[model samples]
Target: MKSLCRIGHSLHSRGLTFGSSGNISVRLPEGGWIVTPTNVAMGDLDPSQLSLLDDDGKWIDGPKPTKETFLHAAMYGARRDAGAVVHLHSTHSVAVSVLEDIDPADVLPAITAYYVMKVGALRLIPYFPPGDPALGEAVAGFADKHHALLLANHGPVVAGADLRSAQYAAEELEETAKLFLLLQGHKIRPLTASQAAALKQ
Candidate 1:
């Protein structure tokens, strides 16, 4: 448990994550989930501070879970293939959220082969107040078509088959967001639809 907790925070100190702004959860092999507690910095997670919730989203045991628990619950419900969910407020991604007058539907592109293959597709969900149920709707809107999502004014969230994969995807998002920022002044060529499809194959 401590090990998992550290992975959450390490991303913060390393500058890939920050601001008590992210949450991580794993579906225990037996059942239920182990989630980071609310308002606690990911870097500061303690085993005792972790919350356990039943599959129904009820507190089976442990401290109070995050108010955003519903968002996590929505992911679990929408994605049977997901074993872990990680949410992050990485700086560059949040920064990109407000820049580049790109269309909402096409915010994510196959600009990089790695992003195309690793993330498949990225969706942008409209902003909702933190801890609001509306966030679940924004997230759910993209769940059927995307594994990664950028919250309008918030951050990014991803569901992976496992924790490592989830973390990796989160890292990839930050990298791409950084690229999106750095390339702001340049002419960029997005991957053609056929090229994007080839990578999917």
Candidate 2:
């Protein structure tokens, strides 16, 4: 709980999350999960009030989970190794999501080795209204192959083997997005496909 709170505060303080624009979840080893409640600022998550769910993803205790809870649930369902998930309406990532020319299959270029290593190939999930089941389904379809996804016109969602891993990957994604935006309209040299594949390997 403390770790989750710390991440929430870090994200908010660093401007990755503004207002209540993000949701986070961590899978419990025994079963089920804990997720941040809806409409609460990530900077102010209260550990005692975190929502708890059963293996089925039903809210069993504490406040109601994020309306976007399905996103987290979909990720967990698709990736057994994903111990935590972080979804954020971060600035640069959202900016990149709305770009007309980005490839939906892999939204970000392999601009840096750390970005390639931490986020791998970032996919795009088509736009859907918040809480829409279709969004969850879209995420589920891609979650199996990619741990990081950019929600069309929304933001990014990332999953990792643990909370810290997820958090770091999410941060790395936002930084990469910022870098991508800065380099637009300029001659650029992204790592070759071979280079990116090597990092993944």
Candidate 3:
């Protein structure tokens, strides 16, 4: 959580997120995980304010786990390759959530080879209330197929090889979301399935 606290503060300071609108977690080197607490100001989150939880969502120690513990737990469960989770209420990415027709199967276009190789397919999960278990379940359901997902009318959650990778992926998600919005009114000549597949390889 100390790590997330620092990252959250940095993100907030840089205007990537604000208030208590985002949460981050990292699997500890030894075991367990450290996560940000719910509704706490990112700028004020000290190590003391963070939560440590076991893989099963059990509080192993430290402050109470974030209300979104289940969501992080589900990520850890579904993606054994994941060592960290980052959920952010970034401005542009959340903006992508309100569109009525965002495709869940392959929401993000391979507008660039970098997006294709780094993020693969970005999915859009349906709207679930804040702290809802169904949100976790939905993410878990698509874990194997995506590295990043846009939560409807909410934000984005990304799971990656490590905390650094998760953070990078979250930033990439926001950047792509902004691109997606900018190109909204235009005809997009995005990469086709075959181009995406070839680039991914």
Choose the strongest candidate by TM-score: 2
The digit string of per-residue lDDT tens for model 3 on 16-84 reads: 878877888888877788888777867778887788887677887777767888878888888888899
Structural similarity to truth (TM-score) of each candidate: 0.92, 0.98, 0.92
Model 1, span 69-142: residue lDDT tens = 87778788788888888888888878877655866775655678888777866777887888888899778777
For model 2, which pairs clash? none
**Per-residue lDDT of model 2, residues 31-106, tens digit only:** 9999999899999999998999887689999998999988998999999999999999999999999999999998
**How many angstroms is residue 153 displaced in model 3 relative to the true structure, after the best TM-score fit?**
0.8
Can you list the residue pairs that collide in candidate 3?
none
- State the number of backbone clashes in model 3: 0
Name the candidate, 1 or 2, with the larger lDDT value. Answer: 2
Query: Looking at model 2, which ten-residue stretch has the lowest summed lDDT?
Result: 49-58
Q: Choose the strongest candidate by lDDT.
A: 2
Name the lDDT value of residue 104 in candidate 3: 73
For each candidate, how many residue pairs have backbone atoms clashing (under 3 Å)?
Answer: 0, 0, 0
lDDT score, candidate 1: 0.81
All predictions: root-mean-square deviation over Cα? 1.6, 0.7, 1.6
